[model samples]
Target: MASCKFLFIYPDINEFSHAYDGNNGCYYYGIAQLSSVLKRVGVETGLLHYTLRPAKEKFLNDIDNFTPDIIGFSSTTMMIADVYEWVRWIRESGRHSPLVLGGSHATLDYKRVAADGLFDVIFIGESEESIVEYCQHYRERPTNILGTVVKGDNDYIFNPARVLEQNLDRYPFPDWTLFDYESLYDMKTHKRGILMAARGCPYRCSFCSNDRYADLYRNKGKILRIKTVDYVIREAKAMKIQYPAINYFQFVEDTVGFDRIWLKEFSERWPREVGMDFYANLNVNVCNDDTIKLLALAGCRRLQIGVETGNESRRKEILKKPVLNKTIEAVVKECHKHDIDVNSLNMIGLPFESEENILETIHFNARLKPKLLQCTIFYPFPHTSLYDYCVEHKLISESNLSRTDYFRESILENPKISQEALYFFRDNFKTLIKIYRYVNIDWLIRLVGYKRAGKIIRLFRTRSELKKWLYQPRKKLLKYV
Candidate 1:
């Protein structure tokens, strides 16, 4: 029998502009893992970054060149509309390869996606094992395969969930070579490396979809699993060899600093083996002075911590994150004490939140004084507790849900704050923080509010303009001297 060929397409309709910057920042790890698994079995696999080129032209060219027997797409909620359009075009263009859909969006909305007729098969939860099994039996009936939803003549056939891989080291390392490595650079920091040392999040924040994802594979072994420390070191060393230009590494995980034992092992070995500066996401609840010291010793230059909201009541009650504001402040201070930069992830326009709550968040962040602040408008993704809450309260309509991009605008309607007001707060949060820092008067800030406070800060714009004008000449004068 001829070996099966597979082509994985990552849709390009990105909500964030950074994805289109030809940087490997948007490389789909799911497809890369599947490619690694497929290559182990001697299957011909090709990956097409459809967003990096003309979608239709690239689609046609890849099909003509690779001649794949099966085409797979890894999609997120924001990319579903574009994926559907591309799938429709593929069918209309007279291609007959079986189309498969996977990833968070497909797994969460399997029934809707299966019934839409765009995908012949949908893999729920993890697909590494299921994909390998499906490809082995490609010539036979695949409807009975576990972890698959097959579109039958009358209806979709739902199969049992696939078991999660308990020992992550069993699988081959993700096929980073499948991507155009030169194109993958961090736009924010200008770094050129990305890796996922683990899978799954233990916490179930109401606004996030990870909890729902965890529920999908409840009995499928441990959901939160990490690669062995040795395996991680090996991959890191290999990446440095493959991309010599990569000076910094970014570990894309929910909480890279969660496991103390694993972190200790990684910290001790990473500096000796890899020796590159790195960044990671950390949960504030798990961080302390000791852990911060350990992370710094491991060559961690920056940490991204979630300070979702400053309103303790709203954060605990609505968001289900019981972390205190004081805890976050302490964590940030400790990280700074260790000479590590901190980036705080904050959100605005949450359900049942008022404008005052938003102001409290601003106050919280300003007081903490993180080196970087990322404030995104709230987006109620489907299958999340927050999404259902928005639905029950009618804060978000079905039409509003179509726009899943969190950065675009607020989709919810609160009686206390208008969408326009939310936009104003989000766009001006950093500037407001700077002003609050300069003034250092709490009662005055509360009295004037964000709008009037913004006006007050604008009075000093002349100084900012003058500084910009003097910057270039000052640099030249220093160089000559």
Candidate 2:
């Protein structure tokens, strides 16, 4: 019998996930999840990073010691150049290990990355099946693999895409033992382990890369899939037993409450079983009063939803979220009614985004009075509607891979909206949100919540009574596209 070592690299880039970059200090414990997944398939995995200024020689030594047959990496779009450095280093080692690149960047631009020959394969979609299959087969047949692009004999045959829209429960519970949890958590503001219950999102907001996962599973389009309730609960319980002291359960489900049955069942069973606070992106289309009721009961502490814009035109035209303005009104009101702690995601700098659009988003968000409001500058990522639009319209001067993050504004020329205008939009609206949260919103809080439940108490007799709040003539968000 022969054995192979696989090194899954979460390259020690300066930035973390979408939320942990720049000003906000956050910890990433995803290595634990990734490692657990690998272990499920009978593979030994280790992480390689030079985070603490570890010498280049020390890094080289570790790579030599591992002597891996395959090296897999996960990265954000902006971190591709950073990946290049690591790839260069690995290549320099002269071992020529088969490199496997996954994560958002590679998922979005697998062909370009594979064509460069930096990696032996690019795992296109959700990696559980494809990756595990590839690793096991690599022990026998390394080249001709499924669900990825490999360095085939005479041509680069990118395998027809497939989305691994499978039962999440089938995979092994993430091995939390693999992470430097305390070391990583000690340096951050928010600390807790995260688990994924489902894969893919059905919605197609223009600014979002939601389909990235489905793109990997199959070349054809499809909606999201969830891990079964029993499977999800089993993992949740197993993780609780494993972590013991973990108080927060963070789920990376693109939209957590998409199904009312799962939400209600999880909510009902969570407290008695896992008893942890959780945070996830909840889709407005799926959530209603009953869903919020279940979530609150289930020990969910935070619900993050996007109110990308308030402008009717922007919401439908630019944002491409089927959410009607009225639906947004109902969703926010319902969340507040249930007293669910809420965070609203807002973005500025869509190519044609104007000050009027910004104002509309702000005015609309003000109605919900979310516990936290984040305003992010948009970065055009590969394979999204927004990215195509920007490229086609020649919205920016040049597209530099370096500017895929918040570090720089649009590098493209002829940007429909100026960088100055984007920041101005953020500044004008964000300040109001800051001030509202910091000082004068106590009265508003009472209106949205109820007592004895530690949740949102309804201010009106029924949702219909809140009609005034949703459709007030004076308060209507009249901001523009």
Among all candidates shown, the one with the greatest lDDT: 1
lDDT digits (tens) for residues 400-462 of candidate 2: 754245533545453355555555444444544433333222343233321311121122323
Q: Which ranges in model 1 have alpha carbons more than 4 Å from their true place?
A: 18-25, 52-58, 187-189, 438-481
Q: All predictions: root-mean-square deviation over Cα?
A: 6.0, 9.5
Taking the tens digit of each residue's C-alpha lDDT, what string does model 1 give over 1-481?
Answer: 3379988888655566543554444666678888999999978888776554356776677677988999888888777887787788889999988899988888877877876778888988888889998888876757878899988778889998977878889988888878776675452336457778999988888988886887787888888899988998888888778777778888888887778888898889999988889999998887755788889999999999989898988889899888988888888898889889999899998987887898789888889888999988888877788888888998887666553677768888888787666876776677767655444434434645545544544544443642343345544423322
Q: Per-model C-alpha lDDT, please?
A: 0.79, 0.65
lDDT of 1: 0.79
Off by over 4 Å in 2: 12-34, 49-58, 139-141, 163-165, 186-188, 212-222, 397-399, 412-416, 427-429, 434-481
User: What TM-score does each of the candidates earn?
Assistant: 0.89, 0.81
Candidate 1 lands at a TM-score of 0.89
